[model samples]
Target: MSRFVVTERAVINAPVEQVWEVISRTDRYAEWVDSAIEVTDHHGIATVGKTYAERNRTLGPLQTRSVWTVTEIDPMKRRVDTGVGFAPLQDVTNIFEFERTKGSDGGTRR
Candidate 1:
């Protein structure tokens, strides 16, 4: 298969720490993410070396379930890494990063 890089961003009206608190929870993905319909399965803290059991719909009638481990995490910079899918079959790695900038009005620049 071909490998391509993908980037995603979200804007939240909260502080970096505030956003981190919410985003770090793997079980709450269904609340914020569109694909993560349910956290059917998982093990892991919000930090690195944790694993998450997840079930998700990918496209029309396509879905996947697997143990996604926290491969890398940089909470200070709001970055994370997760590995998904059957390793011996198809491997999918997800890297999530957040940039927190300061706005002039003391708001978080998400």
Candidate 2:
């Protein structure tokens, strides 16, 4: 299969630390991620080599469970995870980035 990258961007109206608190919680992905239905087996803290289980729905009635491993993490900067159960793709990596913003409201641009 061809290698490709998919990116999603959003602007959170909160401080960098505030945004990091929510984003760093891997178990809470189901609350914000459109495809994530549930998350389990989270190790509580985010660090290299942590593993978690997630339930995802990609299309109409198409659901999947993937065991994800934390490959890299940079607090308040970036986080990377690789999945093992995503078939046809061989591998999948997800990265989240947080950038501090300077605006009247003074929040974060994620």
lDDT, candidate 1, at 38: 84
Q: Where's the lowest-lDDT run of ten residues in candidate 1?
A: 101-110
Q: lDDT scores for all predictions? A: 0.66, 0.82
Q: What tens-digit string does per-residue lDDT give for candidate 2 at 26-104?
A: 7787888787889967876676898988888866888888888899888988888898776546689888888987767
Residue 71, candidate 1: C-alpha displacement in angstroms: 1.2
The list of candidate 1 runs beyond 4 A from truth reads 86-89, 105-110
Q: What is the Cα-based TM-score of model 2?
A: 0.90
Against the true structure, whose TM-score is highest?
Answer: 2
Query: Whole-model lDDT for model 1 versus the true structure?
Result: 0.66
TM-scores of all models? 0.77, 0.90
